[model samples]
Target: MGRTALIVIDMLNTYEHEDAQVLVRSVREALPGVKTLLERARAADAPVIYVNDNFGRWRSHHGEILEAALAGPRADLVEPIAPDEESLFVVKARHSAFYETPLAYLLGRLGAERVVLCGQVTEQCVLYSALDAHIRHLDVVVALDAVAHIDADLADAALLMMERNMAAELRPNGDITFGDARSD
Candidate 1:
């Protein structure tokens, strides 16, 4: 467990597109893998950062976001749940969490030489964060089934985009065991 962090990007119950129901539906498939990764990071004392979008606004708070999401139209479909106090949450106003955010400095302080990104639509938030990691020269690995999009093509393109264009590699859950050393 070298200097690494697990970045769970935009998994908030908000911005639950693809018909809010699709959020849990899509995440249901990936949650286990993401959870496993999180657990390992916790045991290894690695950082776990939850990067979320400000959803088109600058002055946004996590509490406000959750309240609006619950009172919003998709309340039934979108379930806004809060994380335990131990986790770190980063609110961003753009696609990339690193854009005008303290993510870079936080990771630097954590001595994170690598970032494992997962969450939301692979076509959007996930892609941006991964590229930012690449630009910072941080190692990146994404789980294949752990990400998705309403438009299959967009998701496929996003995944392929990273693998071909940004040098991101896919780490399947089946091949990885929690607490196992990350050889890459």
Candidate 2:
């Protein structure tokens, strides 16, 4: 099998605030699992790509994420972590990373055929990425604990949907590491 890539969508700290944090949605609960995957990917030298939502501002997403994170009392909150010099950062304007983004080319260049999709608003961005992965015929898996949304019930529903309909295996965070080549 080809090497794998871990795509983390919209896991930045900017969305962690209460107001902008989506009262009915959040990925905070998934942070631990997401972090675990990141650490493992880093250790294994696997490509860990941050597929950030440009949020429609074509010119200033980097600043927008920062401004959103630092506005008002949120300034005291942790800054949205910058993509490390080592990791790849792909800013996306739309829901799917494969749309209007070089993500596909990047993956091709990386020689990765398997992808682990994880991140916030499991019903939204995460859902879109999984579907896109399936459409693209890439081997896709959605990390279970590595996803979050404010509505716990809805989040669970989304997970079930992905499992049954999308063929996305839900692996609980901490139960597995990414460096392992086995799909399980």
lDDT, each prediction: 0.71, 0.70
Root mean square deviation (Cα) for candidate 1:
3.3
Score candidate 2 by TM-score against the native.
Answer: 0.81
Off by over 4 Å in 1: 15-24, 56-58, 66-82, 174-184
Candidate 2 structure quality by residue, lDDT tens digits, 11-122: 6544444545563134445666777787877787888888887656668655566566456443432233334557787888777778788888898898887788877767
Question: Where is model 2 poorest over a 10-residue stretch in terms of lDDT?
Answer: 73-82
Top model by TM-score, which number? 2
Clashes of each: 0, 3
Provide TM-scores for the models: 0.80, 0.81
Residue-wise C-alpha lDDT for candidate 1, range 1-184, written one tens digit per residue: 4476778777665544545565556666676666666666677676778887767766878666656667765454335223445777788878887989999999888777777787776878888988988898877788776665555688788888898878987877454332323654
Which residues of candidate 2, in runs, are more than 4 Å off? 16-26, 61-82, 180-184
RMSD (CA, Å), candidate 2 to true, equals 3.2
- The pairs that clash in candidate 1 are none
**Pairs that collide, model 2:** 25-150, 26-149, 26-150
As a whole number from 0 to 100, the lDDT of residue 20 in candidate 2 is 57
